[model samples]
Target: MSIYEKIGGEAAVDAAVDIFYRKVLADDRINEFFDTVDMESQHTKQKAFLTMAFGGPNSYTGKDMREAHKNMKLTEDHFNAVAENLVATLQDLNVGQEEIDAIIAVCLTVKDDVLNV
Candidate 1:
């Protein structure tokens, strides 16, 4: 089964996104990247992106990772910070370690793209 289905699908994605954003916003390490962002819109986009990434419904039509974060000048530290927050979010939701590792593996696939390297 898809990780989405394994983790309770839409509702789980929604909850994770919301909690993840809260953590991101509170995180001094990477919060500056979102200073001017329209968080509501960002949240929606994130939900779609994660859903697609997790092999659920693919309604995501956003820019590719490179284009989406090209101007941000993200570094490995920034990427790690986000990854940490994501792991925390999943853990907070009581997702199993295997699923969290799987989810992060998927996120890692776009690391170079997000960093524009």
Candidate 2:
């Protein structure tokens, strides 16, 4: 089964996105990047992105990571901050470490693109 299904599919993704965004918004290190963002849209995009990333369903039609973040001037610190928030969000939701690791592994695949490296 895909990690998405193993982790409870849509409901899990929804909860994780909500909690993750709250954490990201509260994080001083990365919150500045989202100051002008439309969070509702962000949330929707995130859900679709994660769902696809987790091998659930592919409804993600947003820009590729490199293109999407090319203008953001994101640094390693910013990336790390987001990763930390993701970890914390999963932990808060009682997701198992192995699954969290799997999820993070999926995220890591986009790191270079996200960092525009």
Candidate 3:
């Protein structure tokens, strides 16, 4: 089975995104970036993005990472904060370390794109 399937597929992705964003919005380090965002819409987009990233389906219809985050002046600190939020969210959901490590590896591959580097 795919890693997505191993981690319980769409339902698990949905829950992770929900919990992830909640922590993100509450985080002073990154909350400011989302102040003008429509979180409900963002939540839906994240669900799709992560679904694809986790190998569930190629169904994300949002902007590409570089285009999406371009001109946002994202720094490594911001990136780390987001990563931390993701890890904490998965941990809170009782996802195993091996799965989390695999997920983080996938995420790390997108860092340059997301940072517009």
Candidate 4:
């Protein structure tokens, strides 16, 4: 089974995304990066991306992560902050430690794309 299926599928992903974004948006440190986007669309795209990234059926045709984040001048510090928020969100949701590790592994796999600094 795909990682997505293994982890309770769409409902799980949706929950993760919701909690993750809530932390992200409320974070004064990172909110500016998202100030320009329409949050509804951002949420939709995030879910789609996570769905595909975890081997779900959906196709994430979104822009390449590096290019998508290039304009933001993302640095390692920003990426770590986001990762921290994601990890905390997962913990708050009571997701399994293994699942949390898996998510972090996946995020680490994409770090090169999200952090050029």
**Highest lDDT model number:** 1
lDDT against the true structure, each candidate? 0.86, 0.84, 0.84, 0.78
Query: What tens-digit string does per-residue lDDT give for candidate 3 at 12-77?
Result: 998888888899999999999899988889888778767766778874433488888899999999
Per residue, candidate 1 scores C-alpha lDDT tens digits across 49-104 of 67866668874332477788877889999999999998999899999999988988
- Model 2 residue runs over 4 Å out of place are 59-63
**Clash pairs, model 1 backbone:** none
Q: Report the C-alpha displacement of residue 27, candidate 2, in angstroms.
A: 0.2
Q: In model 3, what is the error at residue 68, expressed in angstroms?
A: 0.5
What tens digits encode model 2's per-residue C-alpha lDDT throughout 6-108? 9899998888888888899999999988899898898887777667666688744334777888878899899989989989998999989998899888888
State the lDDT of candidate 4 residue by residue for 33-69, as single tens digits.
9999999999987787667655678644324777777
**Which candidate would rank higher by TM-score, 1 or 2?**
1
TM-scores, all models, native as reference: 0.92, 0.91, 0.91, 0.84
